[model samples]
Target: MTQVRVESPLATLSPELSAQKLLSRGQAVGGVVVIATVVLLLTLSATVGFGPSVLWYGQFAVAAVTVVYVAVIAFKLAMVFRADGSPVLRFEPDDLHAIPDQDLARYTILVPLYREASVLPYLVERLSALDYPADKVQILLLIEEDDTETRAALASMELATQFEVVLIPDSPPKTKPKACNVGLSRATGEFCVIYDAEDRPDADQLRKAVLAFRLLPDRVVCVQAELHYWNPWTNWLTRCFAAEYATNFSLSLRGLDRHRLAIPLGGTSNHFRTDALRELGGWDQYNVTEDADLGIRIARRGWDVRMMVSVTEEEANSRLGNWVRQRSRWIKGYIQTWLVHSRHPVRVWRELGTKRAVAMHLTLGFSTFTTLINPIFWALFVSYLITGPKYLEPLFPPLSLYAGLATMVLGNVMMCYCLMNGCMERGLHRAVRAMLTVPLYWGLMSVAAYKAVFQLLRPSKRHFWELTEHGLVSHEA
Candidate 1:
């Protein structure tokens, strides 16, 4: 592929030359278990009048944590509201007319796979139909060395000149990041992006991303385009999934981009500068949510991420078991990322700055923690309303009790309103009614969070990558 706009080229650092990637088998799980055990014992001792003279200290500690959690949730809701008030920078076809075709950049595209042969043909067709110059675009079809079935399908493809097959050696963590790293090692373009086998990116997405890179400051090294499902109306489940994604991409992430805060990149369609990516040693093969971990790493190193106006359509997992497996892996990865960064709190705080460090905790840490523990609080809140106030009243003082009532009213209302507005704003009008069933959707997420925590604690499935089956529906959004 022909290269383009190689500015201030930093020397590429090979995998062998860089420090070994951190895999999350022993570090996070063991450390987390020890911390949890100590906290539990302290709480128990306080309740039994063995640790503190101040009779209410232990219960106060728990209440204080809950107060902080609710406060942050309210703050996040404010960010979304503020984002809606601000203007969004959108690119249209007229804007794309300024750049000449001769000046267009070459971009390397990677599609990592394990056993995705069933969808290879549709993937090839979509990639081939991208609006960018064909000669400047090179797709690296990455397959594991042992995946003979996918390899056979690749051999049969007619667009041999448009793509190249890269065989990755068998590795301990058979993750998407590992395959992406192998593809990155062989990438020959000035800019690069990744797409799953089931994605259909907007035709002018590359152009908008290229323009964003040229127009934005040098510190902005990556651009994330919007991701939404194509078959949003396939079922009730898919509608909720689509609404959740729409709110995150269009509303939540826009705020992060506006304030120059780092956002966890979506798994696909994140365009990056080759030199900057190499400077950071590529993706972490150990972290399940490598995109998010990499985003935080970029911010710590004094770089920024931006959001593009274009969209990439993906297949929504319609099946219950498939959605649960995928969601659990994602939540587990977020936990891994939080633990790895929190290991050196002082260093990370100094590097990421107070504002971004807090944002990172709210984005990664709070999400996993809330999902894992929401059920317990929900039970308490429900009991207070349905059964009687006598059940859990003594635990919380007046201030904490008032705050809990406020959060319950404000949080649930904000979430439902957010989903409805997000769907309507994105022209996904069909999903608004699905908001009525969102509480049930959240319950399922908690179920996945429990599974994620269990898997992270266990020794056997710590590194397992449960693949989500795609190509179930063939609709275009």
Candidate 2:
């Protein structure tokens, strides 16, 4: 069989989807104008002694935006209650037994590794447990050229014939998606999925994904499995992380699917038709969050990504520094994905339609915007409590004050309730208590969001992939 040399097809196939250019000329100009206008307003207000009046209107604008954000969250919570119409697919035991070993589709599993030697053994064990025929399944472990630690670890292991170690060439953008592209070129399977080093997917996940593909319409080319932490009991951080994942994978993603909106896929456990993935250009090598970008591209091409009922348990970042490092990269990737897609608004609007186009903006653009501005709102609330609302009251008139108050009161209440309910639904009762401290988690997110913005601004650091250290927890719960 001849091997295909696949590169970042975004440059050739669709330059609009590529992250090669961080921002288009139009977007940059618009951004500069907006920044200049804000600066001019502040300067004029300070020099002309009209700062109070400018702040008064600014407060009302913020209050209105907050209402929209809270309303979106409320919509997600409502979707959780209406799960019967969710696009998540589930299969019974009988469904699995009905398929014979000879009839199963050829499946490929790609594991991208970088300085993850510690978890290599665990990963191999998990992959070995996948309930698929050995002859039909192909396992490819993608390792970077300079990653001697992982290479040495794999060399020592007594591996099976189905397992092959694929060395990625030294490249400029040394990213996971780049390595996965090399793996995709060599894949012989009909369907493929990407998994991180510390992932432990359910034994029947691949089979379930195959069944989902067969049962769904031909337009559905990918199946995304739910991801949650296996070590939630490890610490306060892990517990909080697990709670967020519970809501994200189980509720929020389902909401997007129900609405036929573009689903921002999780990093691991996304199963794709091998040919469809290749045609879509594998993944954007320049984008840090390649998975999210691919999900949007899938939707833009008129291909659908369905949610599978299977789960993949991963080790959460147990340390604060590690968590922030990982989060900053993800946030940075979201920024990249948004900028890449927003380059041609009219085309995107036409392709995704009004509803999906708006959903994409809210999911990627507005969510990141909120993370960056959350600190301002938090500081204002603190000031209101400290100095009494005397000076602030003028800024927030009766209507704006009530809306802001409701956002402060009702927003937090709804979010916390969603977190707790997500935990209860997922049988993660221990994590329910950690939901109360989610405000603290938001502070951490703000720190990461700022870090992401800083990195995004630096040309040298824009494509840097922050490696999240795994194998921190000794054992899983």
Candidate 3:
């Protein structure tokens, strides 16, 4: 006997499918704009040269800048390698045990959610399973008041008694930092940590952090746990994203801490001393990258932020469009942070000391410049290739060209080494694949960089939060 099965109406028209279609349309538009801009720039560079000599001069200038930028990055990498002679912190298998019942401290875990209903269940389960005492931990699910759907979802959860929901009042410049501030006001813990909705932090992440804090002195005001992704194999985009983060958090940040420079706070699993944070007025609402901005402020005020050896796992954006949106926001925030700090450079130097101030600028300021100006280099390169020596003569002579090429090659080698080191540290099985995607990763970054520049120019036009979807990994499995 044959039976006919009927499909549910809602199953035929899934909301997830609809949202993905909308996202794809937006991404297509963005890609078109980027392609158009690149074409226009290349055409202008080729045709607008006043004369052969002038064209060569412009090319020379571009080559010189590129060479200098690469050289600086290479130098920084060398310094980082030399400074990290030994591990500043270390963790062992036993460190994964639950926090001692007698020694548990009141810890606040703040998770700021905005239109994140899809991943809320996974986030809740991850938090509930942490190897910390349920009674000692206070998990605040910070949600914007306008996000009623997410709010209702939280209400439906049979959450532990320790879990609570805090609604952020609608305010101008609606941002994550503001939501964190609302959570901060209601927090009643000795220590606090920030986690995003997609985080699947190690069960003992908090336990390890607590132990480190107790061992260190009171001056250590914040502890940043190492963050890595669990789904690097999802696609090339995810692989590259994992590599980039591994280098940034694992190598660059740890090196900065070794040199006693201001280490920018990463977005998640950053445990803080509640008193210290409250004293600084929580996070700066105006700074788009509030985590980085707050880290610097704490350092300048004579507090220290340390790095925990423990690692937290999170999802990497697997889709190209999602990756671009996430990267654009990061670049935009970096630009905002740079402007805010550079407004009074001399004063900042005096407060943070010359060495620290220079380090901060080199890392943050140089990062922003490198990303924003990357497309210019590509444009000039394409023009030079098309027009041959006629277009290249004005930029640089043969000797300078050789020097530029050498510097670029050396810089890339160094970056590759750093990325490989990150992959090995995180136990990534496909390190070679991550290395191969470096160029594609850079191309995506170029697209995001242009978008970020546009956003910076008309900051008022940037309002919507391009939230990256999570829940790609299942906890039960």
Candidate 4:
């Protein structure tokens, strides 16, 4: 039997909504306006003395915003412990038993692979353990046309009856989202999910997601399971990575859910209503962080994305170089998502309402901005500490200097505190000690942020997907 190739033009489906091109016309105009405004302010500042310069007031404004953002971070950290009940959907043993086999919806599992042959056997074993009815599920291994290694590896394996191999035709923009779009076109189920090659999800995750969707409102079209690492104790890098994921998935996202804000979908373990996903045009193939982009689009269309209490354990990148390569791509995609969504702010506000729109910016745009500007603040603080605030007085002022100091010191402490609590919540107690050294992880993130910025500036590298090699670390922890 022969399989026909299928694809979706998610990135370009709507020219105004896609990040296929670096910048839309509206975004370009917006960028120009922002630059011009900054230039005018700087020129006015140069005309005035440093004490009362417009730039000084501008610095004050930024510092004030930073203070507020830090406070929000602190609040989210607090929510990690203080929230009365789980903000995300949680099911008991009886809840799983309540849904009969015949009542379950047809499911599609898409695992897009490129040069990931090493993990094929383990991936298959783990996926086969899923609790869904075997006859009702369709498992698609989306391999690229040119990935001969993975294809040859699959050829030798005796796959289950429900498993099918989908060879995505060789194409430009060889990204995971593009392969996923291909799989989405061929999905034959009421619900669909994407799992990476190295993921080991809880056996009943699919069932939990199905039940969650049934219990939630019709507008809730997606359920995101929490993502943690299978090898959190692999090394310092992996430990830090685990702590970060704990904070992100457990605290930050759940906090957003509690407040009815937009929740960005994780890279894997995101289950979606097939029809709703297709209606949203799948994912942006050109965007490196397609999950984040899709999540925003879901919010913009008045749809809700909820988090399920299930877990998907992935192999964290333990190697430093591999971690940076992966993180840089993520940060780069975040930049792309921010720019793509910020093109039409007015329409977004009208669609998502004022609160959601603001939340989206704080989630996407402002976070990216903060990551990019963090080094600048760090350098200034270092200078302040070494020079005793003498040379930096003009720029910082007395009040602004203290405010900036407070934001820096308190923000890092709150983040570290959140990570520690996140570890405890997830039962990664050993990783709690590593949270103190998480600042080193932040340094790596800044390194990745700069790399992402450089990649965004270069046309050829903008959409390049840096592959993170898996199957190297033992899953002992």
Candidate 5:
């Protein structure tokens, strides 16, 4: 008897096709649920002497807002997809070959560490292996003065002569941005980039960013590199997290650049002009998400931020607790930034001009607020399903319900489309399995958003750096 080999479920499905299928299925399922919920609510409302007018009017308002928001985003994405030439400063490795090598700009890389000893070895090795001239690159391992264990690990490594340790003076509110500000004060490079201790960036990322700077207009002050993950297959949490990163870095950011709006800077691999950064007072020590706050400041000051195609592969938060902590910090920072900027919206809009100011506020300002609102909306939906029209009676009418359902469906389709575009761009189409985790991811984000809001209100509460522990290491023992 002849035996046939069996293919695994994943092996049998074409990654590209699977990604498309997953996106389409999600949109369909979500649309159906939203529509059914609206219809059920409307029917119950009618029986309780509530007309459909309220639902229709409320949905009309929501639909109008959603249409405009999505249209702006879609147009921006199209522009990014159609753009020519590199978005970053590009210096060919061959061009460096002719520069007599001695006149090359000295580059400094700052990796701010706080209780990250486990991943320090890998980070150090990766930085040392970069394609740039080792002699010209100064790798500063910035550590908190009190993080003795991480300092000890760095001392143990027989590192190359190019690497040096910079100990930040101990201070209250020990956050990464504050540590980075201290490092910035000591940096002597013509240009600099920030990396996290857990990052495994591409060796040529620096070279590409330098080239981009040369090609961009004088107004361009910073180059943001695309961040991705190498081990998305390890678990569901990681896979979903990686997908979110890919979508934001690859599509959302590029789209932002297309519209000439402020692109919030990522936490790592962001190349900046030393003089310009210095003029801006470096990173904000008071803000939790200093990078994002800085981006808005740059844009308001008439400087441009561009995105480079170069990809940096880093680890995602594998543990749920770790993910929540990291996310909470980010959301908290967003709330802080939004409040700070909106404090003088009229002045800000006048400085940034109308379009960019509005864009910045909506993208960063409303993001956390929207996520926090999701839980309340979802709760109302479930209540309507269980007790009929009692919960939704105060919100809207029947016709408005249908309109709201349509808007929700359309918005979800757009979101999925944007995500699919990123996956297709990166050739990680198989990673779409992570799409199945969207509901859970949204729920977690809702929880984090609410927590962030609470923390933001209590300004006196000192928040600590919730470190994400890395589980995978490729460095040799």
Candidate 6:
């Protein structure tokens, strides 16, 4: 019901675009109650026989958690192979040019910023250089009203007529989605797309997107392009990042699109039909990772999101601290989105059906829960090494013990293999050696995941966006 119904011609004219609560009253209260119950149980266990309590808890939590994660990883393994075999559309620049000027749709590009003044020059340069028809494209530089520094920097530049600074009124939540909502309200285009300040997308990305929308059925409403870390050779962190992106954008996402599963749209380079976006109430202002939320929402509204082959080059967070902050925010938002949608589990399952509902959990739910509980599993591993499998014995009987052992060993190996295959497919040679040491990176992610869980539990900081600093590395795209 959120998206514009295909049968409803006046859907675009009637706007239900408004910023709403981050979570429903029922959902928020239910979450708080669940957390309180867990705390109380833990406290009670401290007074009770700790061994008995720990045995049952560890048995269910550790074994079940790892097994579920392995299943999800198995799905990803299939996606890696499926993506390799799938074909993508390729068009020469002349093909786009051949389409008459008036036939092309007017495109609106929205880039929301807080304190990104440093990258404004390069951003303008990259955006202005897009090969899309100049007259048909409008770029909205959505800036926060209170961010005087960025606004001043933007003012200093002599931007083209297409580039306009759309100042968003100061508001709570103050997330990128909030700024994006303001820009969306004033957007005048047949289609709209989002870009990060440091992104340098393929010049023909827009044309490719338009072609996708044209060729696909009415139900296909959004298209996400391939995202790549342009400066992957910058550092160890960036190299690992490149491998992750390769797996996610090139392999996993394409597989999702091919199978008609919910595609978690990347933050940038997600092209949407303007009408469909508005019908979904634009972006959830409170969701820090609104792109992912919107992708799921699009599927719920009886629409599908497709993937494009064009690459959108983005800057990698080279600094460990900066990378952790960004990763934590994303994990936090995934937690939020999952809670919001799964509030009515039956309704979600009924709406999306079995396959898609499962896809949602394995994607968003998998990332959030696995990262948060990974350290616990690691601790269990250490405990097993020192003592034995007494804690794990209950979950894995004599017959299943070997299988459980294989899961433990194969889980890490599979992930490393996925990273290597994805990296090699993308021609990122540096990541081959880097994958051998990627477990350390995963430990860092666990660090961020813990931070994300703590932040999510804090009601006051639920919407607090830990912005990642871009422009650290600039290389030839």
Cα RMSD, each candidate: 4.6, 2.8, 10.7, 2.4, 14.0, 5.4
List the candidates' TM-scores in order: 0.90, 0.93, 0.83, 0.93, 0.81, 0.89
Candidate 6 off by > 4 Å: 1-58, 85-87, 387-401, 475-477
CA lDDT of each candidate? 0.80, 0.85, 0.73, 0.84, 0.70, 0.80
Candidate 6 local distance difference test against the native? 0.80
Candidate 4 lands at a TM-score of 0.93
What digit string (tens of lDDT, one per residue) describes model 5 on residues 119-180? 87777778888888888887877778888888777777788877878777676667777777
What range of 10 consecutive residues in model 6 has the weakest lDDT sum?
A: 1-10
User: Residue-wise lDDT of candidate 6 within 1-477, one digit each (tens)?
Assistant: 011111111222212222134566676799799999867776777787544474456556555765777777777787777885555555666767656767999999998887999898888898999878788998988887789999788767788888877777675767898778777887899899999999989988888888778887888889888999888988899999999999999888878877888888899999999988887777877788888888888888789888777899899999999999999999888877787777778888988889999989988888567776778767867888898977556765554556556765887788899999889889997679999999889999999988987887787778899989987875454
- Report the number of the highest-lDDT candidate: 2
As a whole number from 0 to 100, the lDDT of residue 209 in candidate 5 is 66
lDDT per residue as tens, model 1, 358-378: 888889888678887789888
What is the Å distance of residue 135 in model 2 from its true position? 1.2
Candidate 1: residue pairs that collide: none
Q: What count of clashes does model 1 give? A: 0
For 275-354, candidate 3 gives per-residue lDDT tens digits of 88887767765456778877787777888888777778888887778778888877766666665666556777998999
Error of 1 at 433 (Å): 1.9
Local error of candidate 3 at residue 236 (angstroms): 0.6
Better of 3 and 5 by TM-score: 3
The residue pairs that clash in candidate 3, if any, are: 56-393, 56-394, 56-395, 57-394, 57-395, 59-395, 60-395, 60-396
